[model samples]
Target: MTKPPPTTRPVITPSRVVAGVCLVLPFVAMLWVGSYARVTPALLGIPFFYWYQMAWVIVSAGLTSTAYLLVRREERARKGDGR
Candidate 1:
């Protein structure tokens, strides 16, 4: 019985760390920004605090996407997909 080839997997990598950080940043930001203080602004008759959270919706999406992409790329590289 012949043993199968061992898989080339990374125990840790830079991309993985970056991706993980990216994923956590928005949540931290949301918590800090939301409960830290209060702001009053009249943008289209909307309050500053309200708009701040709303704006983070987009920012969070972007950060999550970036994290996803970085992790994916690292995974691909680890798998040796023609890198």
Candidate 2:
């Protein structure tokens, strides 16, 4: 009988690490509010703390999208479809 092809396990790559960082940065930023809790370096008169959180809204979206793309690309590559 012919042997079946080996199944490959998913492994962490640089892209995956970047994806992880992208996914985690927003959470860390928000959770550590004390770092941005200030009035200086305000943007257009908005307080630093408030503006920082709001900025993360857009940043988070980008980061999420980036992470998603990175993982998806890696998955595709693993599936032998990256070319």
Candidate 3:
């Protein structure tokens, strides 16, 4: 019987490290910023303490998207997408 061919999965690369950092840093920043702003006053009409957390909703989305894109690119490259 013929043996199955060996898989050619791409090894972990620098992009993976970047993606991991992108995923983790924003979350850590969000936590620290939220805590630091906890006792601050309002800005314009919005509360200072509230804005950081609220802004993180958008920032988190951006960070997540960046991470996803990086991971997808890495996967595609691994699959020999000619990157």
Candidate 4:
């Protein structure tokens, strides 16, 4: 009897692309320091540099969660489990 071929490669889909973008956005925003490296436009006396990073802490959480959910949903669908 012949053995079945192994499924070694991952499939790339639109949902996966969106999830990847969602996950990468936070890193890009934080790493590009020049964009947020400033002291003007203070918020409640807080410097822009400080406030921008702090705000990203919250935004990053939301974006990461979204990416996780998207991947999880795609996996579940692939497994034929609607729930």
Worst 10 residues of 3 by lDDT: 31-40
| Stretches > 4 Å off in candidate 1 | 1-10, 33-36, 81-83
lDDT of each: 0.80, 0.89, 0.78, 0.92
**Tens-place lDDT digits, model 4, residues 13-47:** 99899999998999999999999999999999999
The sequence of per-residue lDDT tens digits that candidate 2 reaches over residues 1-83 is: 99998896777789999999999999998999789978989889987888888889999999999999999888787779633
- The whole-model C-alpha lDDT of candidate 2 against the native structure comes to 0.89
Cand. 2 TM to true fold: 0.78
lDDT of 1: 0.80
On TM-score, the leading prediction is 4
- Candidate 2 displacement at residue 71 in angstroms: 0.8
How many pairs of residues collide in each model?
Answer: 0, 0, 0, 0
Among all windows of 10 consecutive residues in model 4, the one with the lowest summed lDDT is 74-83
lDDT tens digits, residue span 1-83, model 3: 99998787656788888888888987688668547565457766787777867777898888889989999977787679653
| Clash count, predicted structure 3 | 0
Each model's TM-score? 0.72, 0.78, 0.70, 0.88
Q: Which residues of candidate 3, in runs, are more than 4 Å off?
A: 1-10, 33-35, 39-41, 81-83
Whose lDDT is greatest here? 4
lDDT of 1 by residue, 39-75 (tens): 6664698877888788889998998999899988777
